[model samples]
Target chain A: MPSDSHEIVTQVYAAKKDNKAADSFIEAYMPFIRSETAKFTGRQPSQSDDELSIAMFAFYEAIRSYSRFKGAFLKYASVNIKRRLIDNSRRERRKLGVVSLDQPAGDNEGSSVLSEIIEDKGRPYDELEEREAVHQELAELTERLSVLGITLSDAAENSPHQKRTLEACRKAVDFARSEPGIIEDFLRTRRIPLSAIAQATGESRKTLERHRRYLAVVLLIFSGGFETIQEHIIQTLKGGAER
Target chain B: MRYIVAECHPAYAILLDENAELVYAANLHYSVGQTVESPVLMETEKTSGNRSAIMHTVRRAAATAAACLLIFGAYRLYMGSADRSAGSTIFMSANASVCMEINNKGEVISVKALNENGEALLSGYSYKGKDKATVSDELVELSISYGYISSGDTVSFYIDAPESGVYDSYRTELLGRLGSYPINTDIQKYDSSVQVRSDFTVSTQATSAQPETAANSTQSYSSMTETAETPAADTEAVTNSTVSTPADEQQAESAYPYHDPETYTGQSGEGNENWHGSGDHGYWYEESTDEEENESSTSEDTDQPYNRRHDWSDGYGRYGQDDDDEDICQYSEDDCDTSSESSWNSWFTGWSGYRFYSYCEREEVSECGGTDICTYDTGRDSYFSCEHGTECVQPDDTTDETEETEKTENMDETE
Candidate 1:
């Protein structure tokens, strides 16, 4: 209603500030995440409802961590969508015979692996929530990594989605940094369909459905990687996209 | 998706899905064997851009890159056939030449007197005589024209300028007076001292300005028969290539000056030290008494010239002072002891509104000195000069008595 959508976003941002209430806000917005990720769904062979769940949690993360000053929550949410999609694609490629994670992949396999994406659902909801929690813990554990001559950026980059996916996921976590409840309100007003939101936000639907593995992590120091609210927090996104 | 020659320009082309639904094609480039891999559709919508294929021989992949580079003001010139014909004179003079000339990181080779009358003329770098090279860095080579270079009916090689400068001499042979054929290139690795020089005067039109008095056509430039008096400017004069400045053009220009001179005093012997203003613009010095002295004494093929053309160059010695005197630029009371362009006749007097040094330049200068010393030149002029460096003022051309009497009027001779 204001000159920019950023104006409406500011409200949701205000609500997300209370980390205690971030879960409802995230749940209400999971549909948006589902729809956004759905666009990239067919592109990955391993893409499934489960991946949607992880992306949903990621969306919750975007909601919880989003800041109004960063513009519309959607803009910040876009990066989260891409991260979940790519992470899921990369994981699926490795799980299937399509791509070998340990091998030095030549350029030839890049296209072939790209073609093999999106044949199955993403990781299950329970498994993703556990993984998300461990990641959160791992992020906290990594603070001492610098003592081992490991840089946060370097280690993060070498991890799952490399530094890029970590950054994407991290962005979603910071979504609630500003006004908190704006995402929930936005989803309610728009009546964001979970699947539609999932596809758009790139959060996993499974992660969206089982939304509290991370919601209880409020007492956990918002330390680096505690998927504290991962279930209640984030999800892998699904969508059909061009490589 | 395949491309045709007509709309192959890539801006406008209609694309359709197998279902005949219109697919918006933002941009695309396809050659004879080009392959366009389809996107993988959703399990529910499994048909858009879905394919498992390999492709080959793409000149470039950015269906949008060409347009993007175009936005960046860069373009590609796909070389064509017909370069073998010696007399073929293709290309217009309004634009930078692409086919004939070449440049390295530091130096630009002016192709002023190329004779296309011979078989090697058209084959400057394209395969006929040389092999195409692949470089890991950005490369640029432009030819101005193809003809002969000579001032009159005779192509002349003029000698001027200092040593550490870019070229030793600027010349163009004129058996035929080539219009303007300059080879301009951006050197990814610009090392001033190590740039390659072509001093040989074979039937080759391109030659360095390293003075060659009695060298034969076959004489190697490295084995100098005789070094010219001044460090000759070895600029290859291409047909009609002027490399002129834009008075104040906002358009994009080369960072290198080729033959542009910048004096230490910072005025333009030809122009100002555009090192900051524009890359092509070099530091310059104006004419005044001290400039007269240096021009008279130095035969070292003119070290970086304090410009003769710019009056202010000589007046301030381009540093806004004089060449003969030794004074640095002026700053605030706390910064320096003096002010700049305070002279009655200086351009800064009327236009500058009030005397305030360009803060950027003022910040870098050392503290000012006491007893501002005004010195004389070969021509004997005087003005307020600093202790370590001389001020940029002209020598009093008048006789000694007149100079003394004039000093008496201002009560300041700076003796």
Candidate 2:
């Protein structure tokens, strides 16, 4: 199996050199071409879409010309597909005036060819009901912790209460999030490695060991995935001083 | 992360297969074999088309050139006619029977005589003068002293043609050539008592060179006295009078003979008598009118202190001396008010204003600190222990605030 981009590109070039092999290679990548064209055209492209044809031709051209020095063959092919589709769009725009979506359909009365429907995605409501979002995130966190034989409630119970202790735990969590290898190890093993955290944060091992599960949960929130819950918690921590 | 990355490839494969069905595979395959044409080569091909259109452009250029030449020729003809219209007047003398063309500048363009002798002498000659003439030939200069005279103010040579016969007939033939404009018959003669008098004056001027220097020296002396005793502004006017040439002073003296300088201090009734006694001489007529007006206006001020002294100096030398006492008094009051409030300062500054010292010069001598310094500090500085005293600082703040208030008031007044 090809491991690197260079091996993949070399194989594609070799396949294009043979007429029979080139046909199979182009046919195999045809779905990939249609998907990239759809990404730009904002819908599933059909046989009638000129952008699909342009993207396919660009992919075929890329297979013929791509070299190992250019890095990834898929990336090179995607770039060519995008560029050709844009060029076709510009050409069509000059040749034919843009048809507005609001134009009424002749065959159907009281119906536009393209409807003006707005999709909200409920993002603002998520921020407004921040408590519900945090509770939802905590449920997901409990499920993730269940695999490690630890519950979300146990992590919360172990959380530092005194201001100085909480600050020390936050320093260890921040260190683990910044150092990707530590976070990756924690995620893979479902455990906080106390020695690494203590060495990095200069906190005593016993203190970090005691708060390790809480630090692990905080690290998970900071790293990725839990964006809304993380923002709410940071705001809470900042307001904690007033309390 | 590994699962997400793995899923992207499968998703891409599905997208490509979906789009590949939309593309006409045969068309895509054909296009893949073809190469794109170079943009540089296409540009060169476009330039080749420009060569084929060159002959069509040449015909257009030739047509435009012909039109430009036609317009230029018409403009030249219009300008030529305008020049001819400028110098086209001809005057004919009724009695002399001589016709001549005179351009706007009064130069003789051409001369034609009706009588034989006049015709013979003036056939090729041109005279260019108001009251002077020149007679010459193609070969030699005949006379430099030859002259012509015209009637009234502007000269035109309808008479005084070059020949001896033209000179003899000038009084009789050209007496009425001036047309309804009454001209003295004596002026028609080709003779000159006036010119002789002018020549005598020139000769006398050449002979009396020493008196010119003596008059100039006296003028310089008078200007120095004016600078020392009167305001500096008066010295400029006095210097201008003193610097006049001896001929100018002679003209002044001849125009208005010496009158009692005191007569100018009275009303216009008395002043007009002296002006008329001078016969209102030609150059001084305007000066006499101005003097008459001055006397009438300043008659009321005759009793004012220092008024007679100022008026006496003005009357003694400069014939048309300006009245400067009012300006002197105004400047004196301004200096006293701005620099000091003391009675001593007021009296001394009032006299100093007329003594030919500029405000800046007097300011330097008397230590008059300008608008910036407080007047209260002038005589009181020696009495106070501190150099400027609190009076100086307090008034500066008051003065600045008042200045701002005054500026706003002035802006309001303008609006």
Candidate 3:
């Protein structure tokens, strides 16, 4: 019930995503980022005033790329701050026994060195993606889903949406399982047809028509994607026969 | 990897290869990594807990990754939400990203990024650069979703009048207010942007809107406030629980055979968390019954009330259900948008603390469609991450509805 920050964050972001303007935005928000970063105090290296500076750069980039797809800018920016902070900590630890030197009042060593190091490390533009980590995260997620007695097949087979679309569909399926009347109530209350579901789910109507046959076994399967699985089986069997 | 004794550690410890020339032999310290033998070892100390812990962490991560690949034979899968409307109008929603900065000057500010639980996502690393320092690990990967007419509206309703002109320009705005994460003590701010590329088939009647203020507010309030309005759902729930008359029994009979709809009468889940145990269907294109079972399984947990139908009572439709009573200022005119605009949107953007925004310059240039179209239409529990904490790497207390209500009440009393 919190007042939505989505509008403000999204608007500010959309209004200034240009790479050319990234610097000005970064400069204006530098103070705010410094303040937010400063809140970390003892946790960060002692000799680092550049914390705000680094966080600002990240914030600027975040401003450029934030979107409705991620929910709200507040939520997204908070995540960004944490990420930048962690990297800063890691880099500082790698330095001399200073592990991480907290910047003394007048010492400029921290910022200069940090800037030099950051510049050396280069842009992580494409490195942001860790295929291995993502894969691991996915496996862990599906494993958790499995604990509920639902297999990936039982979940994803329900709808043939895109990979991301499949993720959304799975959430819907997961929610449906926890609620008692969602399935019947959804159809009756919203007047949404089983076929119309293809929009969110990219499943074919023909596939849906075929799978509507077993509305009971789904309980045994513990997932909503039985129809999709059935269609797969049918296709496989036909293919096997053809071979 | 050459061994060199650097400044931090005393005696013969490992020295950074690059810094060797500068600190080469400031003291009698030998290079850090090469030879384990050194006089400094005579007064050595015990290994610290910090080093061991970091090593353990690396080991655990490697093990987990290996185990995952062995067992599941697949990688991580990120699910996206479809309860979208922000991109219904302007700017192409190309992508969404989470970014951070790194430099020596930046390390001091890293702590604020941690979730209340104290976990860091974009941790950093060090390397040398040319002209300027550029931190790498602090990544910001964008979630770029292109909204194309996946499938046109099949059940088309006739546009009453001379609604002409193709949809050449459109913009969308999204303001999420689902409150904090598991570790976030304070409410985390979520930023959302939406862009849609449309090929609008046009009709002739110039689309016009009839702005009715009082009625519009009430109607908008009812529609926008419907999901957030706790009373409506609570009343339905109460009606459902008390309906035990003979007529009610007959009504139950008239209700769904699979689900006793009338037994609960008008009992709609208002403040309750909406769950995977849906009232109707899950994402499966067809009803395979298994999906129904899954739905029933998750529905029994009472912890989540807003899972089914969330009440926007926390705040109005302005931005969210709480705190923001003053609606977001409406900026429907083009002239107002020309001032100081960011580089992303075309200087024509505005936000008044809530969840609404307007892009077109002139009010008369294009009549607002259904000027009073104020209903929030997407299922509250539309994603997997919300229900089982699947994709939530870190969560917060306000992430749930029960705590939000308690907090809201506490704040109200204080005020």
Across residues B291-407, which tens digit of lDDT does each residue of candidate 2 receive?
322332121111111111111112223222333222212133243321111111111111121111111111111122211211211111111111121112222345357754654
Q: What is the lDDT of residue A170 in candidate 3?
A: 39
State the lDDT of candidate 1 residue by residue for A1-243, as single tens digits.
232353235334443443334445555665566667666675332323555555654554455445433456776776766675686678667658655544543466544343245454555676556545544454453443434344332321122211222233333334422324534533245222335434545654433322211211221223223333222223321211111
Error of 2 at A181 (Å): 1.7
Residue range B40-108, candidate 1, lDDT tens digits: 112111121122111101211232244234323321221111121121111111111111222222122
- Kept native contacts, fraction for each prediction: 0.00, 0.01, 0.01
* Per-model TM against the reference: 0.22, 0.18, 0.21
Tell me how each candidate scores on DockQ against the true complex. Answer: 0.01, 0.01, 0.01
Candidate ranking under TM-score, highest first, comes to 1, 3, 2
Give the Å shift of residue B133 in candidate 3: 88
Q: Which ten residues in a row have the lowest lDDT in candidate 2 chain A?
A: A1-10
Q: What range of 10 consecutive residues in model 3 chain A has the weakest lDDT sum?
A: A212-221
Write down the TM-score for model 1.
0.22
Residue B143 lDDT in model 1? Answer: 23
RMSD of each: 29.7, 37.5, 38.9
